[model samples]
Target: MTFRTLLMASTAAALLAPAAQADVNIYSYRQPELIQPMLDAFTQETGIRTNIAFLNKGLVERLQAEGDRSPADIILTTDISRLSAAVAAGVTQPVDSAVLEENIPAAFRDPGDQWFGLTTRARIVYASKDRVDPAEVTTYEDLTDPKWQGRICTRSGTHPYNLALVAAVIHHHGEEAAKTWLEGVKANLARKPQGNDRAQVKAIWAGECDISLGNTYYMGKMLEDEEQQDWANAVNVLFPEFQNGGTHVNVSGIAMTRAAPNRDDALQLMEFLASPRAQALYAEVNHEYPVSPTTEASDLVQSWGTFTPDDVNLMDLAALRGTALRLVEEVDFDG
Candidate 1:
C-alpha cells in the first residue's frame, strides 16, 4: 500500500484506540497517528481514558484562550522550541516526577521540569559516499571548507530543523561563530533552500549537491520508501566529529498543562513514554532514538551505529531562539 494509505490507517487505529478509555485528555501538537499508540498502550495497561486533540498549529494559543477551563492534561510537541514556547507562554507546569527524571537523561529533559523529552533525533551530515571522504569530514565545522563549496543542499532556513541546528551552534560556539557558520553554509548552498529533509537527500542523489544535513530517521524513511528510498540510498549517514564528545542531539518532548484536569493520568503517560517498552516503539515504529537511557535501539536504529551526542545543555539551546531568529533574518537566510 501507499505511504499515505499507511499513514491514514495508522491514524484511524490510534484515534479510535483510546475512545473507550476516559481518564486523560491530551492537547498535542503531534499528529494523532504518531503518538496515539503510546496513549493506547498506556490506556490498555492502566485503564486511563485518553482524549487527544491533535493540531499542527495554534495549540499554545488554544491553551491560553481556554485558561482555567482548559481540559488539557498534557502537551506534546516535536522540538525544543515548541516545547519551550509552551513553557514560556505559561501553558505548562513544573512536574515533580522522580520516575520521569530517572528515565530520561539530564541532557534531554528540561532543567526546570517544565518539559520532558521522550525521543531524540540526531541532526547529522549525509555526505556523498563517493565524493566526500569520511575521515576528512570530521565535525560540522568542516562543512565550511572551500573545497566543498557550492555542494550543500538544505531545506529553508526558517525550518525548525535548521533553526534548532543554529541554536545548537550558538550553544557550542557562541552567537558570533554561529553567525559565521550560518553565513558560510548559506554561501555554500547549491541552490536556494526549499524542500524538507528528504528533499535534500534527493538532491544529493540527483547530483545537485554532495552533502546535506538531516535527521537520522529520515534515512530510514527513505530506505523504506518504494519510490524515494533512493533519496536515502544516494548518501551515507555520518555523525560528524563526535570524538570531541558526540553529535548534537535534539528531542520531541511533552509537558503537562498547568491546569490539567487529569494530572495523575498525565503523569502516568509521561512516565510510560519514558519506559523502555514504550521507548522501543519510537525507535522501531518511527525511527527516532529513545530519550530513555534504559531503552536499546531497535535493530534498524542500531544499524545506524552510535556516536556521542554533544554535551550542550538543552535549556541553553531553547533560550537562544530569539538570537537565532534574528541572525536568520539578518542573513536573509530564507531568500
Candidate 2:
C-alpha cells in the first residue's frame, strides 16, 4: 500500500464501518505529511486500512462530546500535557501490551499505560553560528545570564513546549528559582515572544537575535525546505541541560480511545507503532528520537549531535503544567 492507496477520511463519521472493513480510526494532532509513510507501511503490512481525522485543537473536548459514540480508535498527540488531559477527560483507556512495554522506555510511557511515547525532541538552543560562541550557552540556566540580555528569542511562554521546559526547571530548582529564571529570560528577549519554533530560527537567520530555544527536529525540517534551508544553516543545534540534570525532552505519543470501536485493530496498530521497524520509520520521517531504546535516530538527526536526556519522568512535568502557566503569566513573559 502506498500513500495514495491509504484511506484518508475527511471526518470521524467515515471511520464508522462494519467489522469486515479491517480499518482503524485515528484522531491525530500530528500533521498527515509527518505520519504518511508510517501509516502507509502499516497498511501494507497489516492490511488494516487507516482513517485519520486531523484537528489542531479541541480533541479531548470532541471525544468527550462524542462519548461512546466517537468513531476514533486512537488518539495521537504531541506533548505529555495533552495526553494526560485526554486521560483526565476520561477519553482514553489503559493499554496493556507486552510489545509496547518491551519497546518503549519506562520513563517515556505513562505509569498506568494510558499513553506510550513514540518519539522525543529536545528543547534545545539554536545559536547563530556567526554571532554566538557555542561556549556561551551550555545549560538552560545560562539563558538567564545578564550577558544575554536583549539577545534571546523564544515562542510564547504559555505554549506547551515552553511550559514543559519551565516545568522541568521547577522540577530541578524550586518554584521561586524557576520564576526568577523565567524573568531573566524574559528580560533577555529580543522581541515580544512571538511565532513558532521555526520562526525563531528565521529570526536568527535575519540577525534579529543571537540565540533561540526550539526543538531539535526543526533544524531537520528547516534543512528540508528550500526557503528555510538558510535559516537552518545560520544556526548550530545546542542541547542545553538542566543544572543538575540532562537535556530537557518532550514526546509525541499515542493512546487508545476509551470507546475504541475497533479495539482489536487499534491494538494491532498501537503495537506495530511501538515495534522497532515502525519506530525506525517514524524517527526517519519526523526527525525525532525514537522512544524504543533499541532504535537509533535517523542519520540526519544523529548529525546534529547528542546529549544525555534528563531522567525526570515526563508525567511529573505534566503535573506541574498549571503552575508553569501561572509563572509565565506572572512574569509577563511575552510582554
Candidate 3:
C-alpha cells in the first residue's frame, strides 16, 4: 500500500474503536497561532491528538495531488470559494450531524454538506473618523459617486474578500449590473487595488485615502497589534445599508475530506467545532462572528454593536466567483 493509503488505513482502524485515542489530521488555511487554542481545547477535552499542517496557499493543490495518499481527514479554510473549490475538486464529503445542522445556519453551509462555516466576518467600510459622517454613507453603491473618487483605498479585486463582495452584488443585481458596479468601483480607486485590509486602514490614517472596504476583524487585529493600533484607531467602522441591504459577511469554515480515514473523529471534531463553545472560541480567537446560533460575541466585537448581515446566500455568492473574476479583470482592476 502507498504510504498515504497505509497511513489512512491505520488511522481508520485506530479511530473506529471509539475509545482509541487517535490523531485528527487537519490541513488548515489558518496560521498555527490563530487556531491552536481551539485545537488545544479539543485535545484537552477529548484526548484526541491533533496534528495540523497550516498554510495560506497551495493546500488545495496539495490535497488534490496527494489524492487518496493524502492523510488529511479535515480541511479548514476561510471563505466559501475555497470550500466550494474543495467540493468541486472532490476533496470533501457530505457529512450528517445533528449538532452541526442545529448550530450553523443553513445559508453558511454547503448544500451537499461539504463544508461548514465556523465563523463570520462582515465586509464593512472603514472611513476616516473625522471626515465621513457615518449617516451620510450607508450602502455600497454610495462609493461609486464622484465625490468619493480619490478617497477609497482597497485590496486587489482578485482577493476572495473583494470577490465575495462582488458576488453579493451579483446576488442582488444581475451580472450586467454587477459589472457596472465593478467598473464604477474601479473608477473610484484612490490607487490601484493593493495591500491587505489593515493596509487600507493605514492608508486612511496616513491621508493616502479616506475610505476602504475591509473585513471587520482586521479592525480588531489592528487595534490589538501595538505596532498597527494607530491605523485602526484613526478610522471608524461604518456598517453599510443594514437598513436596506445588510452588510456583506464572509465566513471561515471546515469540511470532512472525501476520503477521510477517520470519519467518526472528523465528524466529532466538526461537530465540536460547530458547538456553541467551540464556535465562540473560533470567533474570539480570530476576531470573527460565530456561526453557532446561540453564541455571543467577544467583548471587543460586541462593542461594535450589531447590524443585520446582508441576506445574500453565501452559496450564491460562491457561484458568482468566476463572473466576478472576469468582471474584475475586464475592468483592468489589476492594472
Candidate 4:
C-alpha cells in the first residue's frame, strides 16, 4: 500500500478503535518490528494494546496538521534535535512523571519533562585493527591532529548524527574552535565525507581510511550481518571523549502528544518503558545503552568497553543544531 494510504488507515483505526480496548496509539519514527517485542511485553504485562504508525519523514508536520484530531498518543523517535523540534512545533506536551524523572538520567531527558530518552548510542571512533592503535585516538579532538590527516572517513556533515556530534563540540568548546576542528577533520577525510557509518567501517577494511566516527551500536549491527562481519572485524570500537568531557552520545526518545486521546494509557506505557525490565529489553533489541542508570547494556554491547557519556544535557546540544549546520556549510565540509 502507498504510505499515505497506510497512514490514513492507521489513523482511522486509531480513531475508531473502542476506548475499551485500552490501546495506546503511537506515531513512531522507529520501525514497528524493532519495537514490536517490547510492545508485546507491554501487552502481556498490562493488557494495554499498542498501535504504531511508523513514518520516515514529516512526523512533526503530520502531528501539526492533524492538530487536536491527531490520534497519536506518543511520539517515538531518535536524536535530540527531532525531539526538540516536536516540542518547538508545539506538537508535544510536557509529561510530569516521577517514574520517568527517577529512571532516566537528567542529561538524557528534557529538563521540562517534555521528552524522555530510552536508549543512547555513543559517537565513537572505529579504527583499523591492523593499522591504528587504540591509544592513538582517545578523544574527539584527536581526530583533527596533523598525524591523522587524510585518514578519516565519515558520512555527510549535514546528517543529524554528525550534526549532533558537531553540536556537542560547540557545547564543550566555543564556536570558532568547533569550526576549526570541523575544518581539520574535513582536511583529513580519506575521500570526501561520503557514506553511512557502516560504509566508513568498510572503507577502513579496504584500506581507504584508518579510522572513522560512528555510533557504537553499528559494531553489533555489522557483526550480525554475515556480509558485514568481515568489515566489523576489521575495526575496533573506540569511545572518544571531548577532551574536557566524556564521550559524545545521542538518544532514541519518546514524548507525549499534546492531544493524546489515551493520555493515561500513554503515560502507563511511558512509565513501563522507564521500568528496568523494559529498559533492558529495548536496549537489547537495538544493541544500545539503556538510559536508565539501574539498567545495564546487553552483554554484546557491554563487550564494547564502556566510557562516560558527556554531561551536557541533550536539550543543550539540540539548541546548537542551527549553529552546527551553519558551521558545516561555512566550512564547505563536503566541498
Clashing residue pairs found in predicted model 1? 21-49, 22-49, 23-49, 138-241, 222-229, 246-308
Q: Which stretches of candidate 4 lie over 4 Å from their true place?
A: 1-22
lDDT of 3: 0.84
Model 1: lDDT equals 0.82
Per-candidate local distance difference test: 0.82, 0.91, 0.84, 0.91
For each of the candidates, the C-alpha root-mean-square deviation to the true structure, in angstroms, is 3.6, 2.7, 5.3, 2.3
Q: What are the clash counts of all predictions, listed in order? A: 6, 0, 1, 1
Task: Report the C-alpha lDDT of model 1 over 266-305, residue by residue, as the tens digit.
Answer: 8998898888888988677778988887788788878878
What's model 2's TM-score?
0.96
Where is model 1 more than 4 Å wrong at Cα?
1-21, 242-245
Better of 2 and 3 by lDDT: 2
Which of 2 and 3 is the better model by TM-score?
2
The top-ranked prediction according to TM-score is 2
Clashes of 1: 6
lDDT by residue (172-231, candidate 4, tens digit) is 998999999999999899898887999999999999999998998888889989999999
How high is the lDDT of residue 252 in model 4?
Answer: 95
Per-residue lDDT over 61-139 for candidate 3, one digit per residue giving the tens place of the 0 to 100 score: 8888878877778988988888899888888889988888999989888878889899999999999998888876788
